[model samples]
Target: MGNLKGVALSLLFTSFVLHLPFAESDWFINYHIHVTNDLPLLKSPPNQPNLFLHCKSKNKDLGERGMVKGQDYTWDTKVNFLRTTLFFCKARWVGHKTRSFDAFVTDRDEMPCRHYHNSCMWSVRDDGIYFSKNNATWGNVYPW
Candidate 1:
């Protein structure tokens, strides 16, 4: 009985140590948008098409809003969901024209977004869209 008790205690201690919170900052994903061109809101004039940013994960909208030129917006993951989750962001304007980018919670080489970092920035330019991870410079983000 004493041997069994010691084994149980050892197992408990091992489990505690393994499950302890990581010393480094927790993994997080952030979505940022920097609007550079004319992006009129829905409430804007009649002739101009309304422009907006939309982000979603597994059919759930994280944050979506009409964007303005020179304005920026960010949305950070609130909780850590161990499994891989794909988050998508889109730049859309009225008349059905849209450009999108996808980022995975898990590190994926094929994905445009990087993992285990701070934040990602999306730059909406007149010519094309781009993204930057952490403090890295912006790189072109192709439509999905």
Candidate 2:
């Protein structure tokens, strides 16, 4: 009985030490994905319709949302342990056209997002889609 207890205690101690969380791999940082509506809302014949958006990752769905001009939608998440995180979004203007784009990918966004205070911003305009990591300089990434 004494020998069995010693063996059990040693096994438990080893498992406990092995399971302890590591500072590096177990650490987490929050990242934000933001989308804005730059196009006109519903109005006259020449005006655009309310922008509808749906965004999702492998683990999360942001549910469809409608936006007026200058409105923004934002969500925060932590990059997964395996580093395969990705988020994509679809946009539509009622009477106009529809578009889809990748909003975030761990491989592409990890460095810039970490460098830019962990945020990615996107703008949907009449002409095209724009992206900015630091939220200052913007470039057209996709066209409608």
Candidate 3:
């Protein structure tokens, strides 16, 4: 009985430590097979204010794979390769400081908007669009 208790304690501690950093981070990557269609909100004015992008994948198992914080909205950055078109609502005009926007990744063959439904919500910030130098319209998002 004593040995079993020790093993359980160790497992619990290990899990907690592993997820600590991820919980505190601001963003994560999406590698699911359900989201394929991208919904764009609004494009930045020609070249005025700085642009930013935030994405989230409902599939917690897939895990994030790129920059999770301090995004400056650069066109030649590495995030443009994800190829997942994001959906933005009217409220996305808020900015990237707030933690309101989120996204999920899926393939063309899987359910496109099954997780988020026909409409996507915003948290009063521009934290929903996937910042890239490619197309301006959010249509079908492809994986990097």
Model 2 regions lying over 4 Å from their true place: 1-27, 45-49
RMSD of each: 6.0, 5.3, 13.9
Q: lDDT of model 3 at residue 72?
A: 26
Question: Per-residue alpha-carbon lDDT of model 1 for 1-144, expressed as tens digits?
Answer: 999999999999888767855322334434332333344344546444355777778757867776556566565552244535567777775654788766434343213433424455566655457666544576665532
Tens digit of per-residue lDDT, candidate 2, span 23-120: 34423878888899988656764344378999999778999987878889899877776667889999987788899998998778777776678888
Q: Which sections of candidate 1 miss by over 4 Å?
A: 1-50, 78-83, 108-117, 134-136
Q: Rank the candidates by lDDT, best first.
A: 2, 1, 3
Number of backbone collisions per candidate, in order?
0, 0, 9
Give each model's whole-structure lDDT. 0.56, 0.83, 0.31
* Candidate 3 residue spans exceeding 4 A from truth: 1-46, 56-99, 105-110, 113-144
What clash pairs does model 3 have?
29-64, 34-106, 35-106, 39-87, 56-103, 94-124, 94-125, 95-125, 95-126
Which model scores highest in lDDT?
Answer: 2
Clashes of 1: 0
Positional deviation of 122 in candidate 1, in angstroms? 1.0
**How big is the positional error of residue 103 in model 3, measured in Å on the Cα after superposition?**
1.5
RMSD of 1: 6.0
Task: Estimate the overall C-alpha local distance difference test score of candidate 2.
Answer: 0.83
lDDT of 3 by residue, 21-88 (tens): 33322123332222122223325542333323334333222332222223222111111223344432
